[model samples]
Target: GDDVRVAAFGPNYANEKFTPRCTAVSMGSSNNVQRELCRAKVLLVPTKAEGGPLVAAYAWALGVPVMMHNTGIAASCQECYARLTGDAAADAATALSIVRGADTDPRWQRP
Candidate 1:
């Protein structure tokens, strides 16, 4: 992640701030989160709600493990977690742990 690598701030249409990496993008859309989820080995959702979220479904279908620590997740979420934390450092550590843990997991194995 290099602290920051070719990042486009979340979809902010009110200000229209989407600066590409000096490259010509086709749609000019800043849906980096989705793209990252698709390419990442695991999906880290910080939200507090995602039982059967379409995003989670997408990850499940794409064979990408999803890690989260919040309430309201459905009982079917074996890939989800509920770690407690309020520090950014802890969040990063937890997220990293989830990412690393998922690397060796066979739960995401495709059919």
Candidate 2:
């Protein structure tokens, strides 16, 4: 969708194909990564190839809703907002709504 912007935080390899809408940002230190992750409304994990439990775990710890295709790691993320609706647009909307409602959730005390 026109509203969705994807930023890939890593080096761009010659063999990789990145769309125009997706910006390739350089990978940073742990603190920088944490700060960047905290700013996102949703953390889309996409596939097992992208990462494993550690990434999902971090997103959950920070209260960011994670959207990923089925994987053992994805299943392990316990946030109520982490369900994949299977429709990309719908999932994105749900993710944004989850972030908007985060302040109201008693379970999520801001870090």
Candidate 3:
């Protein structure tokens, strides 16, 4: 949406297509990573396959909500999960809904 700001971290060749809409950042130093994570309202891990992303742990520790693919620790944890339907629009809508819920849901509130 127009109200949402997306910042993507890591190497993505198609980052140019999402320019202005998505700000791409490099996964450099730990300090840099922490800074970026701290600025985020929700950490979205949309990967189809992942061994185990420790960034989710860091986000949780920092009191940030996570909306990840239904894999790895996300399957076991009580965090939000993004469904992959092979339809880009549908998947995006689902992701948006999850993000909106995270923003308003009291369960995601920090102490």
lDDT of each: 0.54, 0.63, 0.68
Clashes of 3: 0
- Which candidate, 1 or 2, has the higher lDDT? 2
What are the per-residue Cα lDDT tens digits for candidate 2 across 8-96? 55334323466544555555455476877787767776554444647767877887666776676665545433666678779877767
- TM-score: which is higher, 2 or 3? 3
- Backbone collision tally, model 1: 0
Model 3 over residues 15-87: C-alpha lDDT tens digits?
A: 5688856655556555577778788777777776886788987777776777677777777875443445667
Best by lDDT: 3
Please give the lDDT score at residue 60 for candidate 2: 73
Residues 8-105, model 1: lDDT tens digits: 23244224243333333343556554566566665555556545555666666767766565544534565444354567788666556656676566
Which regions of candidate 2 fall more than 4 Å away from where they truly are? 1-5, 10-18, 28-31, 48-51, 76-81
TM-score of each: 0.52, 0.62, 0.68
* lDDT assessment of candidate 3: 0.68
Q: What is the RMSD of candidate 1?
A: 5.5
Poorly placed runs, candidate 1 (over 4 Å): 1-36, 70-73, 80-87
